[model samples]
Target: MDEFLKWYFSHNPVAAASLGAEGYDHTLGDLTASGWQTREREQVQWLDRLSAAEAPSLDDAIDRDLVLSQLRGSIALASWPEWRRDPAVYLSTIFAAMYTPFQRRLKPEAELVESALSRLAEVPGVLAACRANLDPDLAAPLLVTRGLGQARTGRNLLTRTIPAMVEDAELRARLAEAAEPAARAFDDLVAFLEGFECGGTWRMGEKLYSTLLREREMLGYGAAELHAKGQAAWSELDARMRAVAVGVNGGDDWRAAMESLMDDHPPTLADMRAEYEAETRRAREFVRERDLVTFADGEECEVLPSAEYTRPVLAVAHYLAPPPLSASRRGIFFVPYTPDDFTPEQVRQRLRTNSRAQMPSIAVHEAYPGHHWHLSYMAGNPRTVRKVFRTPYFTEGWALYVEKLLHEQGYFDTPATELAHLDCRIFRAARIVVDTALHCEDMTVEEAETFMSTKASLSPGTAQGEVSRYCAWPTQAPSYLTGAIEIDRIRESFQGTPKEFHDRIAGSGGLPLGLAEQVALA
Candidate 1:
């Protein structure tokens, strides 16, 4: 296990350092086409080596499965056209490597500065590799647009955020020197993309989408089954939302009520951050008071603003889990606050995003009993494979499960709060509908965006942003609800307390819902 784990981390040096692997802090990952081929070949070799090894216990058995799943997924991803056509994979990786070390506080400032600069210096070559690899015929228009936005933000991250973090004059000077070249690389990518006619659609079609869900996600269901499930969930949540809206405003129009409630937002960004912080603290207290879940000793989560480059995909809130092997146990819950450069209309949309009525559920999802809580527990485990091989189903499903759990525990404060929670359910439900529709059905990106805006009650921009993410990554968008549904079924038949069930699942260290269900029920 250790031998294969070592190879996995070493193949992606930037991810290694980001994940708290020692001695990889000075290197950036290889983004070239040949580099990807090498990694895929290495993954196949390791998969064979791991398959021949014996597992003496259930835990060991699970670990072996993890290794197999990870290698298979890595290889599958390498085969996908997304890596070459979607610039986010390269651009985000570059910005993430630059900022993640600082965020983790894994090394001293001086050491981190040196490491960041080293990675930053490699940015030009990485971008050039992306330019060479991308096929204009295969590129999706929405992705190209989204990639351009991310590329621009990458330049800002290098020029502004990264330099300000380093106090050493020489390192700062080096950073300044590298900034332009990095910026130019992003510009070159944008220019290259602009030369193409961006009329291409973003759908992956049903066959590839089904294959990804079955193979990579280890899901038993097909796209049609999942689509049916999503449609059912949307119907139920829509009914619940309308009931709340009728109570709130004597009308059945939930979208209007949701919009009105969205207007009730924090007056300032500082106030918004304060609200998020307060909710996290409140959630911790609630968990302690009710004994709803357990966390490891000395575990905590910090609420912070999302990094500028991350704000677009992570429009509302995102939990940055502590690296599995890292010394720090604190997860950063990033609230995507409106940046200072935003226009009035953008600010309004952002304010609507973090409205007071809806924040508690988002806070709960990102912090207590959600990502931060799940990750904090996993961090305490000594198993390296457990840390490295998490399923989005378990992590995301557990969070979504907790949202429903909170509702059952009467966690919502008012009708609006219940409305907000139901609204979230609606959002996830819509993700299922549109995620499959965009990728598997005939739904165009524009059609998906409109559907999301109308059904999920998101603004056009927010809806476009959400749909854009689903386009880049197929099958992942549906995990929040699908994973939760799996857990909910298990929970209904279990004889244990909520805490027991939760601890049992979290103790499994982020397994697939099928494996986790068997473990819990056994």
Candidate 2:
């Protein structure tokens, strides 16, 4: 099992480095058709070997289940035509290869600069390999547009933003020398993609969607059942949001309450950072003071502005966990700032999304008891299987579950804050609806965008970005709500305190909810 997990990381060096694995620091993974085929074949063999392996103990049994689930889902995903059709898969993988190491800063500046330069030098070849793999007819239009956007952003990051951060003159000169070829490759990709007459189809159809939910997520329910769950959750949250708005503002109008809440946003990006920092500290203190759950020793993280290359796809904020093998225990929470080129309304939209009222929940979600907290727990667990296979259902679900746990513990004080938290729930519920509908029901991206903006109360730009991501990663958007609901259901069966329940779930190293439930009962 350890050898299989090592092989998985070995095939994707960039991902290995992201997980704190050593030795892969200076190399980029191959991004060609032949490379993917090699990975696909290896995964099939690994899956067979893993399924047949005996697990004599309960812990070993659970570990085997985790590996099998991940291997099966990965092989199923690899079976998709998207590998040959989606430019985003090839391009984004390359983009992350560059972005992850730099953002984590696992190595010192000089070492980091050397590794980055090595990867940068490989961009042209990676681009050529990607071109060889893609079939224009199968390339979805939404992915093409997304790929072009990321290419533009990646080019800018290589030429502009990245070099500005480095101080070594020799390194700076090397970066400048490498920037042109990388930029030209990006341009070539953008131009080639732009010539495609129609947008590539983004929908995965019902068969693939069901397979994803069953094999990847291990969900017991189907699309219609999940859609109903989303609708029910949305309705429940909507009522709570309105009730809180009425209590806070003497009216039941949630939008107006939200508008009033947005009025308290930071005027500058620096102010936003300060607000996030303060709230993060407060949330951390609250967890300790209240004894919410045990935190890992030396668990810490830093909050910074997101990388320029990721802005196209990232929502308002995202958490990048430390590489599992890295010495640094610090995870990074990237908050998007208003770029200088943005119009006035765009700037306003950015600020509103990160409004002051929402900062506390965001702090809790991204920091204290959310991603950073869960990752710290995982870091302490020595099981390689636990470290290797990550389910978004576990990661995102644990964060969502923690948010509600804090709320119930009276962490959210003001009506505005409570409303903000509920709105986050609403957003996830909306995701469940839109994600299933888009992939299974043939709901257009435009329709999904409208559903998010109107029903989820997301801004037009944010709604569009959410819809676009759902198009690319089917079933991921709904994982937050699905995982949280499963955890909550299992928690209801536990006759213990919130801390006890959290310890049981998180102590198992972020397992699938179904497996976690079984283990807890056993």
Candidate 3:
């Protein structure tokens, strides 16, 4: 059963084609295709069968708890296809998500080009659905254009790349065959984008925005709620952050204090690596010392570089969680080096270029006692179902929470590092504001970008890209803050109860949040 789940989840055509899976994307492009539909139906059937079999086999309460957690997760994916959007949007999203990760390990002979080109030809049909579902309104075209831009993203990555790489002859030959098909797809995508007319006068009506909000809240919560809580938490956290800097900055204004403290003890890229290593060692101690976690000896990870294209869009550092089934796939952390043409001091000040303030905090969030630790446990959990239905909100929330946990445990004793911690919180708060103001509030693209830049101190391009993402996809970003806070609240609620949130949630077998239906649902 575990083998089945692993095989199903890991064979993502998006990942496969992007990495050179020939015809893989084409085979899966028609999500309603017979084979795809059959496999989905069978997956649902297997859950029922597994539930009966796994339930009786549990020998103890803990074993039962683990099994149920996994089961709930599996059921969620099998049931919740509504989260999936139209083809152009989905493909572009696939391209965006995959572009950065694969550039680092992409091969010339890979089948990705073959699969992507074949699927590229299918973009027209996918857009047809968007047109049908959204027409009778002018805003439909803008939405359609946004959808098409996404597919073009994948088409562009494949068309502009793969051929010139001096790596794989066979792949190059295969990629050549895909050239025409890829070009055609690119044209279709461009035509869609060209027809877009929403321009500056565009506004997603309040009712439309509300509909988006409801569907979004289905995955997570509202921004106004998160924003209110974040403002309050920000004040509470600012005090703690300042205290962490008291030795050097005299416990004054945290932002100023951080700058004063960081003015000294500057670290190079190499120093950042060393800091990361030291923190990894301490993370292991934090887990074992407090008996807070159980880490696998078999599971370990190494930090690597962010793929060039996608690296620009993400934080300076990010973690790649391993598949639950692949024992060999270690959890990975990528710390990127900035492209040349900038001064070293300026680079270090940029979060993407600086590893000094980022490496430790990132490792805490992305690796040890963070995403890797939790995910590996989820993977290894006896409840195979819980392992499959991962919620980004739940997973990211836990990771961000663990980051704060480790910092407070005295891992970040320095004022400079402590300031970085608050900066992270600020980043999430900004996400709350950006995500809500753009989608529900219907702020223009430029207005949303300014909100992040002026308040969060984010770069314009970074802010704009993030706003585009929030507008296109609602409620997903706020999960970083909303999900984390929910975890904290649940943990607090459970403090006096017989079972902890950790235990209750884990015991519930990591069921998809959707399946609870609601605590009082009749």
Could you tell me which 10 consecutive residues in candidate 2 have the lowest summed lDDT?
Answer: 193-202
Provide the global lDDT of candidate 3 against the true structure.
0.53
TM-score ranking of the models: 2, 1, 3
Model 3, position 232, has a per-residue lDDT of 68
Query: Which regions of candidate 1 deviate over 4 angstroms?
Result: 196-201, 339-341
How well does model 2 score by local distance difference test? 0.81
Q: Write the per-residue lDDT of candidate 2 for residues 316-341, one digit (tens) a residue.
A: 78888876665567888878775556
The candidate, 1 or 3, that scores higher on TM-score is 1
Relative to the true structure, how large is the alpha-carbon lDDT of every model? 0.81, 0.81, 0.53
Q: Candidate 2 vs candidate 3: which has greater TM-score?
A: 2
- RMSD for each of the candidates: 1.9, 1.8, 7.3
Specify the poorest-scoring 10-residue window by lDDT in model 3.
Answer: 513-522
Can you give the TM-score per candidate against the true fold? 0.95, 0.96, 0.66
Best-to-worst lDDT order: 1, 2, 3
- Give the per-residue lDDT of model 3 (tens digit) for 283-343: 7676668666656657776665554444334435666665553443366676644434336
